[model samples]
Target: MSEPVKKKAVQHLLVWMPNWLGDVVFALPTLQALRKQYPEARLTVVARPPVSEILPCHPDIDCVIPIPTEIGKRALAQMRFAFSLRKYHFDLAVILPNSLRSAWLTLLSGAPRRIGYETDGRNFLLTDPLPVVKESRSIHGSDYFAGIVKPLGIETVDKTYPQLLTPDAIGKQRELLKRMGADPSRNLVIAVAPGASKPEKRWQTERFGILCQKLVKDKDAKILLFGSGGERELLDEVRRFCPGKSAFLLAGLNLQVVAGLLGNCRLLVANDSGLMNFAAMIDTPVVGIFGPGHPKTTDPPIAPERKELVTLNFECSPCRHRFFKECEPSPNKKPFCLEDITVTQVARAVDALLDRLA
Candidate 1:
């Protein structure tokens, strides 16, 4: 609780970052609060691999240690990673994730003070475990993260969106884009991330393909498809529907490359995923396509006026967000929540966001 911070000085602080990209972005404010609470303490963040690649780019963070979140038949990796953290001599560990492994890692790190939300039966592992956040439409994702640091003397968390990429890096990505055949200077670049982490969250790539071509014709925009290496098949599926000259497939590029390009783009249209949160974190205009998850609770609350969400009013529209098994799969096997959303609705949302930006 607040007693630890009030009693002794925090020399080196360990901030265990969330594994999911969206949750990682949401926790930025908590990191900011921690930095403010212990101005001179060494702040370190440990997260999973791909997202871990970009965490060091932020100015507030002093160090980032990459750790494996998956323990599929082997936890030797987690043990080695945890044993590696003990040398840092962290006086306090702020566990962002509610997983038992997260608390166990903090315990293994030999940190004297460990704090996190009391969930996943990991309360016994934490020194100051707070109450778990309640579910409500009014409570935003950022609030859940901000609540984690309140017990540590951080009264008010800064909700300002941090610039994740430097201007030099963002500017350098233009050459990379030009080499890839996209001219952001000549054409208004609209980056599209058609893939989502969860199957229930992604819109049909065929609609995404059609929407890209329409944007090229109607708005004279150049489409840049962003996705990880694993999403090459999905990226290819969307590019197959796009015009040959205008749309470019950018699968398998570095996350920083995508972030830099997102920093320079006119706007980003993505399904409800980490890339959507990434684009918004770097201050890009985002048009997020919502399916089963309602934007009210799932989306970040920062700069609501600058962002737009498009979803239907179906009875099962805002079903249980995580791994939604409630809805019957469509005949084509696509989840009904995402399959029902038409391309026209998405285009209208994109148009409205662009118009507002203009």
Candidate 2:
């Protein structure tokens, strides 16, 4: 029997998702809503290039348009990108990222109904310019992105970020685990992400090393360090301090393979990096060590029992959005924000997770 055709209320819908992994994760709820509303209509996502790789198998989106680099100047890039968007004849465009660039894209897409925050300079381009509530800034990024879609008649539902693990990735992860002598049956497998986008967001390396040692000694867990190319040096520093049969350093793996490996791990202990949010999207329990970034904005939003399992903190945390720029630590060369977070405290959080699992 043939499946009945979905009567299209609107044919095309476009969403401009953020470039960073964590930001993209927050945009998932909006994509899920679009899927529910459109059902069969083509949904295109205008995502930054690095993020484009994940959208091919994304269950929600039909196409991924890479955000082209402006290359020359701001005006030239905007005009070029705007002209480039003329290709997609969209009926309605939902701009998820609140950047003027994103709003401009939606406008240039010439979608009859473009909806986004009114703050960006491209407000004139949007047909439905929704005001960003001052209070909404404090809300979780997941909730913040969800706000833009409400005007599109998109219903709210819990949308954990989506990660597709391929067969090759699974095979590679299994091989790596086996070579590292990771007992597939008994010992707990934990992935530690020791780096963040900005230096301030990073958990103390010594503290992370201590936490790994404690987990291995106490729970007989196997620790694996995961990070991107940029984080290789920091990961190496972590490896130097954490020594024994139970720990392995696995950095610079392809993102998909890392996701696959994380899928099999018992839990992930990470700083406020994209890796932490990636783990949450894959439904892996994550103990996120948040410092310079707001936990409410960056931490996982799945149920407390399952995702965002643990978060380490200090009194004067979240000093800056970027390194020491927006928010800074104290003067006189004394950094108290992440300094107050001790190794013992993180170990306690890990112990609690072990207790819950047992």
Candidate 3:
């Protein structure tokens, strides 16, 4: 035998997933890689309530701890919640977010080896601070996440995309689709999500409706619509613009259930939202619409043959890291960034996807 193998010190790992649903979904590959590297470590994920639902069912995660409050708000609730993490006695903390609050929580959790990117003044909080490389159009999210562990002798990082599949959720998704008049026999299922984290990121709802209608009419594809409770208005706009029996709306379902449903689709056209990441995770082809965000950093890391996605081309693309609460639109003006994107452009993208699928 060569030399005696040194035993790893850590037994419990706490992964601080991103607070936003989309970002949280994007972080799954990192979680999976950690699980593979530390097979015996009790891997726990700490996330907000909505995002928490997706982690529990992941095969890599041993447990999920819901962050008690909106970590986005730097309030007393967040402080108390940070203290609550101390009970887990996490040996390793993986901070995925670039937020100072996330760093503070990792510090308060008392985890000796805190791993994260060196940014947002959070570098001091981390024991293993990886350099945050500045690049445009090449820094994929999965690769960016894996860079942190490069110094720790963990190589051969898995390049697989986000993974999630619960049998019950999958079964329920099938039943729900059937009830919505989607035929399982025909695999020509197409879905569109007319909502994003913000109005700025969202492609025009009318544009989405027109695309759905065209897909139903020309390709006879069964179109389905998805979103959260907040997307009801956009969904209504999709329905109104369609003006016929072309698509079905399935919003506000449990997040995993929605993911499972999206998994069954042949194609998914969505904004740069959590659903886009979820669709990528389930290996569904996607036509992701990007605006007010960096597609280079956040686009689904699937093969080009899977789907042909569309994003707007404006000089003022990617307005903010996170969305603003209520940015007022100008009088006699729509969100021109997304409005500039035409339904014809989206339809062409979808057509290219269909050709690839065929």
Candidate 4:
């Protein structure tokens, strides 16, 4: 009789999560699968600062270690973080982000098995480099992450929407809404996220303001402006265009608080941003405005009946370029792909979604 094959023991696992909020939301399915695969193993997540804010307290993850966003400026901190990880002696490492830095960190921690996609020229650093499929290149973000982890003996079926807030979090958010003068009982609450990490991805603030005004006038919807501290000016611009009683600006709030507040919203209107994905995760209906970002690859993974994407399909619609310098500007010096998406189009989409809800 042939000898029984020995299963390798894996006691500790480390996952280097994606830096962006949307990407992290997309990767939650894989994280959950990893937990189910190794229920007894200690799983640790190394992530960027914003990740801590978005991820709910879950038993799947044993602990979370946060790192600075600017890795280039914090070489000492990176080294210290890597050294600290070495103490855990993780048996396996999963690199979710395609950046070379993420792969380097996994190598630094000395994990025996490093699994990741063979992208960003970091194949040499990965022990099990998965090939990028053409089909996955244009699919939802959650599907892309699921494909990478399929080789780990985990079934990738059932790509359900990820949840970010617990019951307590929802209650806290209701209290926050009361404090902010938003009466969910009286009017339908609509959350608006006007800022994105890249300028190319953001729709005009003026258009957002116009949309809010129309919603307030026609639908009697209460607008909640959500963004970071840096986006305060953009939020202010929208506020300037809106009636004071119709809109409330909630900038610079922590991620958990924002998620809680978003949970109470009936709808979310946002650019192709992290908060856009957050809304989808929490089961809120979303109307996403796409510019340079490709909807196929990054659209919120929500049910079709509950979400809508507004975009102008020009030849150069999804340039995918990070900066304006790399893009070919229109006569008005703005990317027509987004600039051409008129206020009327967005308002119509929002109206359609609200109609469905009603």
Candidate 5:
């Protein structure tokens, strides 16, 4: 009788990364775990354009395939991406994001072993489908992603926060600061990210302006306001309230540059957004303002002592609803859950962080 042939080990692994910036940060631990399990394998990451930009410098990833951002052409984009991925001949495809679209792409890639959570009705597509537990949804985002890899013999240990930076990026940060009239040598630099993807997740910009003024006056800190170009108008509104040389708007900068700038800061005060997670990843002290989102599910995996989460515990506070249309409007037309959190409360939290560092 002829001897049976042995199965070959996984040599090329393809990872379908999460879509949102914060979600992408949360998946870093899983990416690290995958790298540990298959150290010899060529790891490729498939991500959206914004998420792809932040991941190209990641140590574990060999390459990043960025999908086009145009919503109207995403179907064609995915087809093109799948065709490109087929050339790599991936042995295993890990779908980190629980979406039907992700599963379809994995299926289309013709990977031999497809592993992912059995949510979104895509279980039939996966060779190894891990059952989704309702309780798991409430866990921290980093932990949530890490759990998906446990069935593949990769142990999920304490969350690993990935650091992304280069010497060139750091140098650019210093130049950017100087151009913005910020003297890092003269004063402590504090970064403030007042924008959140969701309007309800954002604390009132007026409150942020007040907090900036207070930080400038009391903490003797230079405010480095960070946000996307889309948020330039919102940052301008905050600038209107905070009129001084102390606050410098650093909008529209490269994401890596932003990460490097945040790394240089003494502290980062941000709404529950991607920048907040980025600060934590870079080991910068963070003061996160929470409102509609619960810190339990999305909190950065930083030491509690180093991070201060300021939030109100309203019954409907952590609705986790993505849009205003999904929620019932408050009487004042503003999210009361966020409106209830006072500037004094957030300032006090900021003071606590500063005092701890001091």
Candidate 6:
């Protein structure tokens, strides 16, 4: 049996946020529910520089302490960071990541009550360890994360995604679009994120280009291609297919700027990735092209109607995230599931979503 907790009694709550941007988004509802349950408690989140930099300004979060992102010295940095958390005297700590290091950090923080899912051989470190799904992504990631706080009495997580965009963010993105020669205020703006963490997860670049070209010609839309600095080559490749068109390469911008720009867009078309999740969270309709991995794992509660997923659901469909690493490509050297998804399929999805919004 779990220990009883007075909902409003918890103070100085510490949350160890997940590393992945998508994971951070999925984990937010749990925190949101906690805020309602413990309104008087001061909530603080610990995240890396990337995740910390992009988190929206939320009333629930009183403070955000960024730990170091130096990969070379990660263990040592976390150990030091954990030691530093002792002074805050957090009344309770919620560990979001399933990694052992996350659990170890909570243990070292000396937080009297620590709660997290039991996995990665770190169960012994938590004061309350919850049962983990056999495969973390076997179900919705948000559900898995929301369940982590059950021990603390946050039982029912609402079927809603957090509102991630602020007025300032939306304004900044609009301004950026203007400077980039994009008339966002007057024209249809569609965001295209062509890069995924795994190459296996991405749809064909040529197909993305075709979709961009179609959207630009049919809807008279401005295309903003979003990606990190490293993905410049990928976006560049996507542009080659949309030559002499409205598609503008927006590679290398920070997540905040990207989110801001995305908010100005009428819709986003992308493969299954954090950016797709980000766009959906911000209330921008998305047409997600997925294969190899199932959307069931990370789909938000109320996002099904707002976003459309294009998957062939092949016989060998949903090899899941694990299969991304060991993917066996077709003779064309593309994932069979994704390669079969035509430009028309994705475009229709985009049109259906946009039409509904219209």
Clashes of each: 0, 2, 1, 0, 0, 0
lDDT of 6 by residue, 1-358 (tens): 2577776557889899998878888888898888887888989999886678775476578889888666445787778878998999888888999999889988999888888888898889988888876766467878888888777767898757556678898997798788877877888888999998888788888888888888877888888999878999999888876646588998887777787888898888888888888788878888888887677776633356788888887765566555536667766567888888899899889989988878
Residue-level lDDT for 280 in candidate 6: 83
Cα lDDT of model 3 by residue, 246-349, tens digit: 57778787787777787678888988887887787778889987766657778776777886767665555555433333344533244555566788888888
Please write out the lDDT profile of model 2 over residues 1-358, one tens digit for every residue: 0122233747877777887888887788778887887887889888775566666778888888776654434776767776787777877777777788777656766777777888767678777788876756357778888887776665475766555666676667777788778754556888899887766667777778878877777777788888777778888887776656777777777566677798768888887777788778877787877655568667685457764434435443444355445444654222455555678767777767756766
Q: C-alpha displacement of 85 in model 2, angstroms?
A: 3.6
TM-score of each: 0.93, 0.84, 0.85, 0.91, 0.91, 0.91
Per-residue C-alpha lDDT of model 1 across residues 109-187, encoded as one tens digit per residue:
9898899998999988998999988663456677888888888767788778666778898889988878877778877
Best by TM-score: 1
- C-alpha displacement of 199 in model 1, angstroms? 1.0
TM-score of 3: 0.85
Query: In model 3, where is the ten-residue run with the lowest total lDDT?
Result: 1-10
Angstrom error at residue 137, model 6: 3.9
Locate the minimum summed-lDDT window of 10 residues in model 4: 1-10
**Against the unseen true structure, what C-alpha lDDT does each candidate score?**
0.82, 0.72, 0.74, 0.81, 0.81, 0.81
C-alpha lDDT of candidate 2 relative to the true structure: 0.72
Give the TM-score comparing model 4 with the true structure, all chains together.
Answer: 0.91
- Measured with C-alpha atoms, the lDDT of residue 293 in candidate 5 is 78
For candidate 1, the TM-score is 0.93
Between candidates 3 and 6, the TM-score winner: 6
Best by lDDT: 1
**Range of the 10 consecutive residues with the lowest summed lDDT in candidate 6:** 315-324
Show model 3 residue runs off by greater than 4 Å: 1-7, 70-74, 136-138, 161-163, 166-168, 186-188, 292-295, 311-337
Compare candidates 1 and 5 on lDDT and give the better one. Answer: 1
Clashing residue pairs in candidate 2 (N, C-alpha, C atoms within 3 angstroms): 319-327, 320-327
